[model samples]
Target: LPAPILRLAAVLITSGLLILGCDENQQGFLLTNRPIVYLGDISYVVYLAHWPTIILWKSVSDSTSLSIFGIFNCLLITFKISIVAHHTIEQFFIRSKVKAVSIVVSLIYGLLAIGLMFNVPATVNTSVASRAASVDVAAAIEWNERVSHNAYRQHRPCKECLDDPEGQRMRGGYTGKGDRFECIWKPDKANGSVKILIIGNSVAHLAISILKPVIEENFPQVELVRLYSMPACRPTEVVQYVCPPYHKALPKQVQAMKPDITMIMYDDAILFITSSKIGQERKILKKTFNKYKV
Candidate 1:
């Protein structure tokens, strides 16, 4: 249970396993196996590519969990890909005959990356004026500038935050505020700011961080935000809710806190058992904010 005991147990178990691995035939089989040796040769390549491959696979499949067999199959597929790339892409470029072709390929890849980094759309939308009504170009520019700074020093892309059409719409900026809960030196304008309460599922988690800085820049007058969310706990007033008991009591708690503008962000996933009641939730939200209207 303790750290030192856990370490000792792990070492003992590993030592026992190593001592038990006395089968020379098993070792010889692995050493001589053609497929195993082939995979071993490109293990480093598989190491380099497997993580990104798994991430891409998860994203494309929209899968949160994979079985043991599924993981094995995924890794097998990745190994196959690694072997192919090692022969075709990596070795082909290294050959003297393909040196110029490699340069051209590299240039094309570089240009494509540069285009995405600058958000160069493949097709231009000519409706400038109507689109301008929707986007905060200045805020977007500021976000792009601060993206690298925001990623905790490691260079990472914020495509979902800055590039996506859905993401742009969600950055509507906080229109509310409240009293300082924890900041050390609260500004004098804090009391004057509109208090915002965001209640939803894990979607609120993304909305919270992504929207915070943009809201601060857009509404200099408003400064307070409170977010409460759980992964599967969609807001609903139905009799059979899968939400935590604490979460079920949050509406009454919000009534007591008296936020100025309450945003009821909900997952719109279709469900037969329990659905997030957006309209009824909106009515509840109205009632919560109405207390502070005076």
Candidate 2:
């Protein structure tokens, strides 16, 4: 396959993994069977060894001079080495030999490793402090309170609203009337800039705060026009749920705003099924992109 096709496939696979990881049920791609459970059994060893194996190979090899063939050869060599190490060394010697004596020995070594991993600053840098300071925490709490009050103001009945009505209403328009939540935008009055439309789901909405400062600093000539939905919805969902009666529909709303660029970030994992279904979605997305010249 082409490099672009391979890149797309990698992206889709990564998205699938993210979805599986985020899923509370831990079913992964296999909803009906226990494939993830089976995989999870050996995942710890794979996780522990794969990174070091890759790093070791890359460290020895001339990565800059590696061609596609060379890369493939490296991968094959790494796979063989990993299989041998896992089956012969890790599984047989470390995991399979779990007698009472071995268990005690393992516990002593395990505690040492854990202590080294956590305590040694030069090894892991465990002393790193959170950027979210006491003031930031207070601000976040204040924001939460505002959102709660806002929810109650909008007559939202969720427990969050009861707790902090003001904050909920201000930040997220969590009115109990519907599933949709309106985004709050505060445009800079001094600098009149062209509106840039932001459309998609929660992820896209989350990007707004991060993007806001960047846009204001870098692209000061542009204003933001946001059209965001909840976690479960996407662009397609916008067409279905948002259109009728609401003056500001989804894509139409975006188009009418006449944004220079439409940035869309959605969770494709919501539509994930089996690997076959994922492949089909990729095909469909490619076709749709081509049809619209997206």
Give per-residue CA lDDT, model 1, range 1-294, as digits (tens): 334675899799757645544666566766677876776667677888888877876555433334345466788888888988888776666574667886878999999999888766633444554567778878987766544223322221122222122211232321112210111111233434455556654444444454454454444444455554444345553322234353445555465546555655544332122124334434443444334311
Off by over 4 Å in 1: 1-28, 55-77, 89-136, 141-227, 230-294
lDDT of 2 by residue, 91-151 (tens): 6666554585587778999988988777765545423435334457677877676444234
- Candidate that would win on lDDT: 1
Root mean square deviation (Cα) for candidate 2 = 17.5
Model 1 deviation from native, Cα RMSD in Å:
14.5
Worst 10 residues of 1 by lDDT: 178-187
Query: What is the Cα-based TM-score of model 1?
Result: 0.32
Clashes within 3 Å, all models in order: 4, 20
